[model samples]
Target: MSVTRRSLLAAGAVAFSGALGPLFASGRARASAHGYGPLLPDPGGLLDLPAGFSYRVLSRAGDPLRSGEGTVPSHCDGMAAFGAGGGRVRLVRNHENRADAALRVPAVDGLTYDPGALGGCTVLELDPGGGLAAERVGLAGTAVNCAGGRTPWNTWLSCEETEDRAGASGYARDHGYVFEVDPADPHRLGAVPLTAMGRFAHEAVAVDPYRGVVYETEDAFVRPFGLFYRFLPARPLGGPGSLRAGGVLEALRVPGVPDLSVVDRPGAEFPVEWVRVPDPSAAGTPIRFQDFGPGGITHAQKLEGCYWGGTGVYFVSSYARGSEGAAADHHGQVWSYDPRRGRLRLEVRFGPAADVRLPGDSPDNICLAPDGGLMVCEDGGGEQYVFGVTPAGEVYPVARNAQDIGGPGAPAWGEFAGVTFSPDARTMYVNAYTPGTTFAVTGPWR
Candidate 1:
């Protein structure tokens, strides 16, 4: 059943009517209705899927492309697809290298940045049959092209997930902002870094069309924990391409945790609320939602991947370390935020036993399957694999990196980072970051 905003508001009101402090205790009733265990495999790698489904490499990093560009760079991260002129598909992919080494590219048309550091974006046009026909640099000269999302207006928002401004001389021009790119006309659009979105380590973005809101996640790993942010457009129902126009940025805050005496689990659901971050430009703003999980007084884990799926927004915590006195459960977690239901709920938690365990604790990008399932890319482990979870909570391996898992020239099958399905849902495209390669897989899902 599709839930409406009004129904969610009513549910929220009932949850908060008695006492906001125990709202989650009452929310348990709702969780029971949607609970499911993670489908990842165990540590020894015994997890396997049905025989029919398989994957193949479409393109890879360092692979000599038809474009004059010498070779694709390492660290292929976020990506998005758009329909092209001749029934083909255009893919805008990011290279997350922040080191002071020049990225080798045959041509520099869509490239940006200085010569020393190797980081930027690339656009590849794939023919209807899933063959790479043309390629070019999309946005060059950026640092750490982490993970970003697709815009509703047929564009890709590539986010730089770093806060380093060493080369900026004082103010960073584009260190930690989302860049808008047109995959169709890669050279025509000058890279416009959206600074008003806030200067933090952004992991991924999920736009809410109904509310005209862009939900973003911060991958802050320093002193303060990361924050879950929402960018409310000044106007109602604005186009996704206009995200750079500016909006209100707010942080998530769990009520009442000042004395350091309160005990709560980080995974425990709470009556969380959105608190405005008076000035996104101000780096001194206090974090609103801090320390509320299993590890008593824990902070928000590094939120990496997110997608809009089945009546809610699904998010993932790459890993959550235990706090002061709690047991450390480095396993990643997936949460659901039902805007229409006005409630944020925990859906699945993956530990060491799942089919695609996060042995290295780096869960990066995720995409929803057409059949109400999820496809996840593992960023940390030595053996990178694309894992899928069925709606029934069954986990299976869809693809594995055939090359090295990390660093340049890594195995393509070991480091799958981004996964997306074609509009028809008949084909799936997966990309590996370091040894940049995008592959198209088509088969019947048994």
Candidate 2:
């Protein structure tokens, strides 16, 4: 059974009772826990938070960057936070623009990897109150640099979300790879692309720090539905920037299921397998993993954001109605991949349209909250919102991005990008995509 905004009415019942832990309750979720309660319209016409919560816009597109000749790059997407000591926080953000979004940031004299590719990463240091301290370009000359993950060692793993190869897409070098950046490094600014990570349309990633295992999601924005992957480092990552040391990449598989779209209903589970990807880089040179199809790899539609939580790796599957040849009909889905159990469970899912109105459709990036809930940033057609879903399937509104920055009648559609929190858990930070802006939110947490 799918759900919609009206379904939120049913959610109020579950939320008020605070009875959310049973996985079976997920299908019944309709309403939300809107953090602090229902959203109060934003008088400023930017973003709306619960009654006791408020936000402060810290950065935006075209603002003169702390360094460089031009304004900060736009299309601000995936981001992570690092403690910069003295109560300051550091953010590493991705500019998902492609080769055409050029000349935005001046490339360093001798540090960039591919001048033909425009996507890169920006590092921002914020004061204790979330005020911008300093900003600089951390990595440059990549393509479609989208959402990435944070390493346990305090470095950011920025991923390239494009399969545009050099010469073909006007790229000087092949694109689509992961790069590591140390936000706190004061001396130089050079990025090393971790070639071992597969070269598909990379989206965001999550690392199992305890095992040095890296899990990735593919954004299938192009041809061929995307597949979920994992990279087993040759050697357990020793510290920051160690991904370049090399590793083996593998895609997920079901022993005999034959298809990856099995994650249909809420709480649906499947046994998992990892098939080796000989040529993770997909580089033409000495090609090894030529037959990616021979492995009978299972496929899913638009595997998006992922986060390593206490129970497993929680990931999102953006809306799918079996369109683009997907095998099922799911508006949105959430799965938890448990390595110990060798299984992936469909923790939650939205409606199939024509039936349910679909509350919080097309969910993308996700992050864990202090209360053990998930803060989901929606990238759909309706009013953009950051929704909250508890372990027991009780959903709530965390924030409503009411900013109509896209001009008149733009469909009220906006992609809420980054959704992360400060190390102290006292402050929350998120980004509104395009005409990009970063915001810090604060309030009581219980």
Compared with the true structure, all predictions reach lDDT values of 0.60, 0.74
The whole-model C-alpha lDDT of candidate 2 against the native structure comes to: 0.74
lDDT of 2 by residue, 292-410 (tens): 56547766677889988774687878866555676666667777888988987777767653234345368899897767677788887767777776755666777777777556655
User: How much is 411 displaced in model 1, in angstroms?
Assistant: 11
The C-alpha stretches of model 2 lying farther than 4 A from their native spots are 1-34, 186-189, 221-223, 284-295, 353-360, 406-411
Could you give me the TM-score of model 2 versus the true structure?
0.89
Instruction: Give the number of the best model, judged by lDDT.
Output: 2
Per-residue alpha-carbon lDDT of candidate 1 for residues 312-348, written as tens digits (9 for 90 to 100): 5667777655552223444566766767656665555
The segments of candidate 1 whose C-alpha lies over 4 angstroms from its true place after superposition are 1-50, 101-117, 166-174, 235-237, 256-269, 282-298, 323-328, 352-361, 405-414
Query: Lowest-lDDT window of 10 residues in candidate 1?
Result: 12-21
